[model samples]
Target: MRAYLALLEELERRRRGNSLAVYKPYDRQAEFHAAGATNRERLFMAGNQLGKTRAGGAEWAMHLTGRYPDWWVGKVFDQPVRLWAAGVTGEGTRDNPQRVLVGPPQQQGEWGTGMIPADAIADTVMGRGAPGALDSVVVRWGGGGDVQAGESVLSFKSYEKGREKWQGETLHGVWFDEEPPLDIYSEGLTRTNATDGITIVTFTPLLGMSDVVLRFLSAEAIQGLGSSPPQGGVAA
Candidate 1:
């Protein structure tokens, strides 16, 4: 009885640890993160339920909070950042990136049970149309000498809103939850151009030979970025 009770306590603590504290990605995921050190844009193409989306969410959390695990060998930001996380539609955005980053959109009580640590979430702006969708989340960034220096903002968007919505702000990073339209992909790249920020696209190559797909798999891209894995992997 005593040992069982202690086990339950350990589980509860891990439940709140969140993001990098608990994200132990497989070999493919780690290679993807490591590639971020030199590459500004990367693509992780994989099959469904292979932990690709979770890895993306975990990396973003580390960037927002500037809290990298000891094993982390990826890009690190020294200050608070403004980033965008998007999908093909509002609902898709909510279900994938939003769900992994902030928890279940449909469950209000479980909002903090995601890659972002519960205590690190400072505030959240609810989305306008979709039920329980989030517009943005303010994360408590800790890179500054003081914890109160400033907070990072993670805005949610959908490609369905078009390239116009993607214009304006200079972002620190952008996470494309899935493969996006070539035009939408271009706009996302533009948003991060000024800041020299990173772009992460995690998706399955359903649209075979598409422009976005070609961009990552082309020989030119292979030479520019590092090598991809044998199985489903990353093209930096």
Candidate 2:
């Protein structure tokens, strides 16, 4: 029947959308994500719309849910992790990091269609002040025959909330989807110090030569590196 065929098509689309096997990162993205294994700090500076956020989001999903693909050569956490993903403001955070990690913020049922696999999403807590935005997400780990292993946590944050908001919690990782103020950036680093956790910053260098940007550039210069410090970018 016509209706039955339509339904089948929809189901197929959802199946493809939820599968991590469909993700194929380009060479630069692969290197960026892989650096987390040895680097405590990383910066993915690129032009706009070059898939920087997408690459970062996918890696965060893997860390939070322990759902790395067999081809994954990135950082692997032995246990469930507590991570924070942030942007410049509440709305920006929801639109960028939240959308990439989960799904469209305005869509209710399509939440698990993003980089995070549907089966790995355990639950979500709605954030304050932003409608349809998630305050945090709980991800189920250990899918290889041990579904009861543990749960990882991913929290959404914003730089507009100030450095004070970034304080008080020791986290396993932090993903900055936009350029953060220096104070906010410093606080985020401090939060992960106890865990020796990683901080991944993915942003276009619109605010050219800011302290955070300079920090990475300076490091590269001091080390006389051929590649960009932390990771380089590809053209959009």
Best by TM-score: 1
- Model 2 whole-model lDDT (C-alpha atoms): 0.83
lDDT of each: 0.87, 0.83
lDDT tens digits, residues 121-205, model 2? 8999998878888999999877677555899999999999888888899999998998899899899999999988988899987
Query: How large an RMSD does model 2 have?
Result: 3.8
TM, every model: 0.89, 0.88
Error of 2 at 60 (Å): 0.6
**After aligning candidate 1 to the native by TM-score, how far in Å is the CA of 44 from where it should be?**
0.1
Question: Candidate 2: deviation at residue 144, Å?
Answer: 1.2
- The ten-residue window of minimal lDDT in model 2 covers 227-236
lDDT of 1 by residue, 176-218 (tens): 9888999988988998988889999999767655677777776
Residue pairs clashing, model 1: none
